[model samples]
Target chain A: MVQAAAVAPVPVPVSTEVYQRLQHFYARQMQSSDDLDVPAWAGSFTEDGVFATNAFPEPITGRAAIAAHCDRAFAAQAAAGIVRRHVMTMLTAEHAAGDGERIHTRSYVMVLETRRGQKPTIYCSTLCEDVLVPVDGGWQVVRREVRRDDL
Target chain B: MVQAAAVAPVPVPVSTEVYQRLQHFYARQMQSSDDLDVPAWAGSFTEDGVFATNAFPEPITGRAAIAAHCDRAFAAQAAAGIVRRHVMTMLTAEHAAGDGERIHTRSYVMVLETRRGQKPTIYCSTLCEDVLVPVDGGWQVVRREVRRDDL
Candidate 1:
């Protein structure tokens, strides 16, 4: 009898359905933010979801806090005569080892900003890592960590 | 007796697997060009692929022609003392009503440009449409059309 070698199991790529749904999830979530629809974007996260970024020192916990953070930020941008758009791409998703309902995803994101009568600028570039879960027949972000490229 | 009403079949969304694969495809294809890997990027098209854009009056058809066009353009950018990056997002994919092997996709694209010691700017923004087919186990572009959002 031949001895079998033990191999480590790597995470499988998410199904086509799951991958596409996540893409749509990100798109809608980002769009809502760009459109200044605070409730819409904030609702993308779970009630107790957390958002952390290198740009800010503190992690924002809970959907309500996330909404408040975004509201203030959007207000500041609006007061500065800036128009903003969020673009996300380069997404890769895989299933978690023991959870069929959980997925890990990484994406590249950029924020485009334009002032009146000015050329659009690449305001920021960041790498976003997210842990997602299925809730209420849709995907929700449980945790998000962002690392700014220019920082 | 009730007569059945005619229902038009709207294009169905492509499978999740296809959507994810295409996202990878575009990322690799665009990254090659941004890296000045001309041949690598050009291989993304079929032998008789067609790329048309509103910015150019003539469409570049065939793999060789597309490669030449890209080569010349990349060279020009290199000479201009600037670095360029391509970011594509907001992708939507649907299947044609009558074709199982064909997929139609639309995406938003932006070219980010930076000169030495200068801030990065959005050089162009466009809407890109592509007709895709699976060839030899991977996806290839059969046709593409681009409309500049800023123009």
Candidate 2:
């Protein structure tokens, strides 16, 4: 038998497969949010997910609460005929030293808002730090903190 | 001696190290352009690099020509007091069937422009397809095609 390194949680490099797997994960997660699919977007997170943003005074906890918050934004965007695209960039991911089920990621998200006959604008730019955990054969964001550049 | 794959240039998986290395490469390359450092930006490409964009009637061939083209743009942005940040997203890298030195990458770049005392705007969103080769222990873009989503 091979001896394993005895260490606690520390940043560990993942494989290329893991990296691309994450690319797909974010692509799907952000798409649901951009498409204003309330249930789908909420499903990207855990049942007890926590979302905190610099623009908001209080953190929105739990998947239902997060969904409620975004549902309103979605309706407003739809009413205004605005299409917002959540573009993910500069994503970096690492796993806990000893826990394969846990991963940490930091990504930059730029939201572009476009209206009919008008040029697209950078509605918002924020950095999202997420703590992800595997559940039911998929990954879910357990905690997300958004740092808005505008704020 | 170890056996090697006989394939020519197919999609080969890279390690996490290569993926992160590319992240750093783009971060530095885009920073130079955003800072209006024309020469520094040109240095990111090979001597015979080619840059094609739909906005231009003809492609810019060679690093010198590319530099000359961007130099004018940099001057104009400087005069207009615009800061354009190039944010890279959804980057996928793959190597040629058997050649380890040739790597192809497709990346999305979002350019956010900000003027003094004004909110930032999505100046441009583009897909950059690049062919990269190592030179003198560093990677240089040998060819690049820019596709603007706004076009």
On TM-score, the candidate that comes out on top is: 2
Positional deviation of B59 in candidate 1, in angstroms?
2.6
Decoy 2 TM-score against native: 0.61
Which candidate number would show the highest lDDT if scored against the true structure?
1
Off by over 4 Å in 2: A1-85, A89-109, A113-118, A122-151, B1-9
Q: What is the C-alpha lDDT of each candidate?
A: 0.83, 0.82
For each prediction in turn, the share of the native Cα contacts (below 8 Å between chains A and B) that it retains comes to 0.32, 0.15
- What C-alpha lDDT, on a 0 to 100 scale, does residue A64 get in candidate 1? 99
**Model 2 residue B122 distance off true place after TM-score fit, in angstroms:** 1.5
Q: What is the TM-score of chain B in candidate 2?
A: 0.91
- DockQ, model 2, C-alpha based: 0.13
lDDT of 1 by residue, B91-142 (tens): 7788875686788887777888999999887787666889988888778889
TM-score for the first chain of model 1?
0.91
True contacts kept of 2: 0.15
Chain A only: TM-score per candidate:
0.91, 0.90
